[model samples]
Target: MEWLVLLLIGLVGGTIGSLVGLGGGIIVVPALLFFSTYTVILNDISPQVAVGTSLLVIVFTGLSSTLMYMKHKKVDYKSGFLFFIGSGPGGVVGAYVNSYLKVDSFSVYFGIFVILTSIILMFREKLKRKEKVNHFPFQRVYTDGEGTTYTYGFRPITAVIISFIVGFSSGLFGIGGGSLMVPAMILLFGFPAHVAVATSMFMIFLSSILSSVTHMTMGNIDWELALFLVPGAWVGGQMGAWLNTRLKSKTVIHLFRMVLIIVGFRLIYEGLAQ
Candidate 1:
């Protein structure tokens, strides 16, 4: 019964995550903590174990979502590849640091971070882009499977720095980093919402793989919990990616904001209550 519940949670998390490029960790982590604490487990789960297992599940969710998005030609391979290069080293550093963290103390800090990010995302639509959107040295034109074209400008150095920060935080917190990357791509780099989502998922796939491997080596993961969630995550990932093709860019952003606000508040509450 517990396994079934976890599978259902994964399905919901993956579906929502893939639709907006959040990679399901935001949803999965809280669900894992809740279940392990009051209902699902015979013993309480440590926050580190819950976080570690969440990262493992993201491996499958990211892979499934990336492949599905790639099929639509929505993923910007060059950008994701570049970000992966920076994130790799950062991920290793984050994992090493996380090993020394205390779960209880880290949870409050993590909660505060999530809430702050949520506040930013809430007003993201209202934030004005500078007139110099085209000023970045590196720019690209990409066409999706539907033949819709998009052009965006970015500074390679800035992108690398941001990717490193995102990767480091993601590895430390057992997140996929798409939460940070998606907003940065759209708001800072002027990427189309769909392209940002697809590209972010691809980058997350690479980062999470590295992070998960590190967590495994540190013995942080709960294999049984991850096993229970993977199958559902796979199916939901495909389902959400398919839905993304049909959704409007504004709708996607709105959904993304809504999820962030809800999850952010929930995390904040959990952090304080615990």
Candidate 2:
């Protein structure tokens, strides 16, 4: 019964994650904290296990959504590859250090990430409110209407720098990595909402893979439960892509920011609870 509930939750999480380029952690983590709390074998320890297992799960989730994004011509390979370069190594280093962390330490770390994420996100929203869209970079990206034209002559440099920061954070936190990538791409670099979401998913696919490998090498991955999760993640990814087809990007972005804020407070509460 609990597995059934998690599968349903994974579906919704994947759908929401696909739409927003959030890498699905937004859905999985919260469910572990609140919803999955009702289930057995996942009571108090669910949050920690869920964070790990979800990262392992989203490798497939990101891959599926990434392929869909590619089909739609939403991928920006130049930037995506650059971001992967840094995130991959960072994930390895992060996993190696995971063993040193205690639950209290994780709570504190999560609190810091939540606050930093919220601050950056709040700043981005402020910029959006004050700035003109016409001045945005990458204005005529993706399609040229008559042709499948794409351009990234220099965007990868800035994106790579940002990716380093995002990847480092991901490795440190065990997050899917999009929690930082999506906002960094959009507000910092002015990527189109669709492109940012799509590319972030792709980037996370790499980061998460490396993180999983590192964790697995260190014997941190739980293969039995991870296998149980694959189906749920697959269903979720497809549903998320479908949802993205219908939702507005701004609405999705705003909602994601809200989740960041709530998660930030939740982490802070947990950290202080001890």
- The C-alpha stretches of model 1 lying farther than 4 A from their native spots are 40-42, 125-133, 144-148, 249-274
Cα error of candidate 2 at position 186, Å = 2.7
Model 2 agreement with the true structure over 1-274: per-residue lDDT tens digits = 6677667757766776677676776566556655533446454643446566777877888888888877777788767877898778877776656667776666667767766765665565444311233543433356633575433223545666667766666655656777677776766665665677788889988888877766666565556566766678777777676666556556665676687778777766776776
User: Each model's TM-score, in the order given?
Assistant: 0.89, 0.80
Instruction: Give the Cα RMSD of candidate 2.
Output: 4.1
For 1-274, candidate 1 gives per-residue lDDT tens digits of: 7878889978977887788787888778777766766674524777677667777888888899999987887888999999888777777778778888665566676676666666655665564433356778878787666677667878998999999988887788777777788888887887877778888888888988888888889888888888889999998889889998996445756665666567666666766776
TM-score of 2: 0.80
Residue 192 error for model 1, in Å?
1.3
